[model samples]
Target: MSETHALDQIAAWRAAGRKTALATVVQTWGSSPRPAGSHMAINDRNEFVGSVSGGCIEGAVVEAAREVMTSGVPKTLDFGVTNEMAWEVGLACGGKVRVFVEAVE
Candidate 1:
């Protein structure tokens, strides 16, 4: 999904008084499915919109986003074929991605 659509989802969730977090694809290497700037917006309800890594790691990103929302602290997550989690998260495609997750006030 487009970054604009993701931002819109964040705004919608906030308007509804829901806490939200945003995960953004900041950097990518090799055969990344999505490019940098991709966004995924997750709400306190665990609902999400858009995607940072297509279908490869959205669940992991959502989990991280939940932590960011609760702690109000941003985190940068790295995933690559070299990492064991790449297989667990289904990112076995030889690519690396850096996702920055932050609570959206």
Candidate 2:
């Protein structure tokens, strides 16, 4: 989804008082799907907005975001989309991405 829509989701979640987290693509290597500064907003319920590594790693980001939401701690996750982990996540495309997730106050 578009970054605007993701921001809108963040606004909506905040308006509704739902616990939320924001995930951002902080670093990238090789041919990652998204570049730095890309955003994906996550809620307490695991619902999300926008793309991090396109659709390839959003689920993982959502999972990490859930942890951040629960613990009120920020997390930096690194995904080497060229390793076995990538195959597990179905990201055959090669690249590495670092996602930083922080709880939204």
Per-candidate TM equals 0.94, 0.87
Q: Write the per-residue lDDT of candidate 1 for residues 27-96, one digit (tens) a residue.
A: 9999999999988899988899888886889999999999999999999999988877866885767889
Which is the leading candidate under lDDT?
A: 1
Worst 10 residues of 1 by lDDT: 84-93
TM-score of 1: 0.94
User: Residue-wise lDDT of candidate 2 within 7-51, one digit each (tens)?
Assistant: 788889999999888999999888888989999989988888788
Question: Candidate 1 at 44: error in angstroms?
Answer: 1.0
Clashing residue pairs found in predicted model 1 = none
* lDDT of candidate 2 at residue 82, scale 0 to 100: 50
